[model samples]
Target: MAKMRACRACHYLTTENMCPNCKSTNLSTSYTGIVVVLPGRKKGEDPRKGSYVASRLNIEKPGKYALKVR
Candidate 1:
């Protein structure tokens, strides 16, 4: 199986050429770590503000995210 590609803009990982999360074509294969954000759990609180991992990655919405996209 091939590794998932991470979006450069949102760090969202996907197998498709176009990122489903940010709809960005800028994707990279060089990424490290993965984060799955659960819905209805951390509602109202911005992941880019409250959560340490999400904050560091600048993730605003709840979804699968790459810890580091390079």
Candidate 2:
């Protein structure tokens, strides 16, 4: 298993040393909860169009995100 880390800038969860989305090295190992966004086009299923979850969490990409950061 890979150790997950949260991006300090975007709170994105990943196991790599740098965030693939933001390409930032600022990551935290201590975080809680996870949010996964499924990609599709529906009435309210599009994250790129700015869903409530994506807006509230400041997430632009559809992937695993950290709900809480410490």
Candidate 3:
């Protein structure tokens, strides 16, 4: 299995030490839950828009993301 790392900045999950989305060095090995965003039908709008997951998680980009970091 591949190792997982959570980004402190954006909660993005990746195997790399550095977060690909935010380029933040703050990474955590302990995290829970995962959320994925799909492309929105309208321009300049995200599919996750108005979703509690997006607002509570502070997610702006559409991709695989972690819910929490510990």
Candidate 4:
């Protein structure tokens, strides 16, 4: 499997060279911690509105994310 890389701009985890979340090309292999934001219960609902982690991290989408990237 391809090793996942974390986006420096948004901290999102992806295998692709570009971050699908923010389209930032700056990615890092040196990262610690992982957070998976699940989708909201209702359709078209924002997860950040209900998820504490998502809200604290300012994440708007549901996906795997790195807690810290270097």
Candidate 5:
């Protein structure tokens, strides 16, 4: 498996050079904790609105994310 890097801008985890979440180039291999946000059951419903972690982290989409990125 390809090692995942954390996005410094949005904390999203990706394997690419740029962050697909925020389109930021600043990525870090040093990060702690992982959170997986799932999409809402209904279409057009945002999981962020209902998820405590997502709301606290200000995540706009559902995906794997890092708790902290250095």
Candidate 6:
């Protein structure tokens, strides 16, 4: 498996030299906590509508994001 790097700017994880989400080259190999946002919702509940972490992190796009980037 390839090592995944997390972008410092957007906190998006990728295996390339740059982040595909925000096109940021400032990536870090050392990071902690990973959050995966699902694209679907169960029943009538919205997934990201009032998510505490998502809103606090300022994540609009649904995908894998690092909680802390170093």
Best by lDDT: 4
**What's the distance in Å from true for residue 22, model 6?**
0.8
Return the lDDT, model 3, position 66: 81
Q: CA lDDT of each candidate? A: 0.82, 0.84, 0.81, 0.95, 0.93, 0.83
Per-residue lDDT of candidate 6, residues 1-70 (tens digit):
9988999999998899999989989999999999886554655444457577777787777778888998
Best-to-worst ranking by TM-score: 4, 5, 2, 6, 3, 1
Residue pairs with backbone atoms closer than 3 Å in model 5 (clashes)? none
lDDT of 2 at 38: 62
Model 3 agreement with the true structure over 2-62: per-residue lDDT tens digits: 9888898889988997999989989999899888865466766754575677767767777
TM-score of each: 0.73, 0.82, 0.78, 0.95, 0.93, 0.81
Model 1 vs truth, CA RMSD: 2.4
Q: What is every candidate's alpha-carbon RMSD to the true fold?
A: 2.4, 3.0, 1.9, 0.8, 0.9, 3.2
Query: Alpha-carbon error at 66 in model 2, in Å?
Result: 0.3
lDDT of 2 by residue, 1-70 (tens): 9989999888988999999989999999999999887664664455856577877886767889999988
Ranked candidates, highest lDDT first: 4, 5, 2, 6, 1, 3
* Candidate 1 lDDT score relative to the true structure: 0.82
Clashes of each: 0, 0, 0, 0, 0, 0
lDDT of 4 by residue, 1-70 (tens): 9999999999999999999999999999999999999989997688899999999999999999999898
- The TM-score of predicted model 6 comes to 0.81
| Cα lDDT tens digits for candidate 5, 1-70 | 9999999999999999999989999999999999999988887677778999999999878999999888
> Is 2 or 5 the stronger prediction by TM-score?
5
Candidate 4, number of clashes: 0
- Please give the lDDT score for candidate 5: 0.93
